[model samples]
Target: MASESSPSDPAAWLALLDWRRQISALYARVRELRDSDPPAAHALWQAERNRLFRAHSQSPLLPEARADFVSLPCWPYDPALAFSAPVEFLPLERLDIPSSTGQAMPLVRFGRVELPVGTLDVYWIDVYGGGVFLPFRDAGSGHESYGGGRYLLDTAKSADLGSAPGGALVLDFNFAFHPSCFYDPRWSCPLAPPRNVLDVAVRAGERAS
Candidate 1:
């Protein structure tokens, strides 16, 4: 763990703040352009992510990995894999999910979303300034994607893709990404729970490199 006097501590916090700001801005543009040109919006998203991974101070890649980084191993953008799914509200049930930091995060199961392939529980951080959280593991996990899983919406850090006119959450699998913990264990991230694991292979997101 980094100490308060460690030079990298402050820089890491500031870099993470900047990273969140950039991510929110990127998603804002995605919401605007996704309707008119899905492919172009996807391209913009991928290019910006590549830039962040390669150049951003808050990147999860190690020094050696960043030195030779080119692009994330991702499946091609497929429109069919994207959807605006309606939320099915459930009786609020609370659970604590273990994190990579060895601490548990309090989460409330507020709803569930049914995709064409399977269903996923939608959670809300049961803490101050709550934000929606949705993480899932597919059949490809441990082989094609991270063994723990990937995140679709972690609004606490401003990783949101926006909502539809009918109030459905815009879930674009092409934009799905591995958590920071996937690359570096220094970061604390919540892993997907048992109910959120899907039986189908979701082949349109970031893959193991």
Candidate 2:
């Protein structure tokens, strides 16, 4: 953990800034590949993600876990889980929700997507440089996957899966992944709210090992 004085230290601040830049670049590359070839893109994403978990300075895994870390267990890419749902724009309604960090972040309900399995509300974070946030929980929770939920798209942190024609957003459940908090308790992440919870078992994403 960084000390209290680390934030004020020039070297530490620069290092953190560099880390953010690297992560942004990594996500950008993933988006580019996803637009071209989704399967290949996902494969690359998994590989790069594993690399980050093993070698990145800001890996979420504890030191002891990192030594034995290989790759995150994920279900095979399933095309059935992919969808290009139309976005139903919602009224400008904002809600303040508590985060794992114990801070309440304001989020605006921007749209709703109706998938074959169910419907999910989309939210836009009400903050500077805000972006789309989509978290979902399924029956697999507490067993195969994280008990809290998995994030599908959090564009603010650059986990975009791409979009379809007519402004429909592409949501590929096979790309769903666990938040950092899943690996490290010290990290705090938002879980799937009531509206985002799905009764169906979405067995095509990252799972607990």
Candidate 3:
């Protein structure tokens, strides 16, 4: 079940609504621009993400950290990291995922995709309404990106980047991003499991400076 904000905190409710709208807009723009201009789309997406993290009222950053925020350090767009992979659905199985906050969320393993990096299992979040969830960690995790991992697709919160024709999902590493917990300890985000960890160094996504 989803948590609810206090009825007395109207500001909190408004902030949550604003965040949902912003995320939806970002994903929609990505879907529109990726086909024609992938590089441009990536650049714009990064800029918008920076703006949200730095300027938005409902940013995930801790209150004390926002003042010094400039932009998230990210690697340049690399076309080589983008690929269209065929999804192989696994027999439906639910896995209980432990969170940073000690709560467990159930995610159902629905499919797998083989990419240049490796084969990765795709999970469907087991909530009121289901959504795809893809998180990964690479060799560059501790040094380049967040130590835990980064998110490639978390459609539950509108981070989808769309798919290609012929039933292949567009797995773009250029769009891989850090979870909210990277900035604020209050947020409990799901990390990439052992199966999702790639042996290769994915040096094309968002990194820490």
The models' CA-based lDDT, in order, is 0.86, 0.80, 0.85
Ranking by lDDT: 1, 3, 2
Give the CA lDDT, 0 to 100, for residue 58 in model 1: 73
Collision pairs in model 3: none
True-vs-predicted CA distance for residue 94, candidate 1, Å? 0.8
Cα lDDT tens digits, model 1, 168-195, are 9999988888988888877778888999
lDDT of 3 by residue, 1-209 (tens): 12332546678888878988998998899889999999999998999998999988778888888899888888999999998887897799889876656677789999999998987889998988778988888988988888778988888888898889986888899999998878776677777878889999999878987
Candidate 1 stretches greater than 4 Å from native: 1-8
Q: Looking at candidate 2, what is the lDDT of residue 78? A: 84
- Of the two candidates 2 and 3, the one with more favorable lDDT, higher being better, is 3
Per-model clash counts, in order, read: 0, 0, 0
Residue 171 in candidate 3, Cα distance off native in Å: 0.9
What C-alpha lDDT, on a 0 to 100 scale, does residue 43 get in candidate 1? 89
Better of 1 and 3 by lDDT: 1
Lowest lDDT block of 10, candidate 1: 1-10
Q: Where in model 2 is the C-alpha error above 4 Å?
A: 1-12
Model 2 agreement with the true structure over 22-124: per-residue lDDT tens digits: 7678778877887778788778878878888888766777889999899989888887898888889988789976656665677888889999878899999
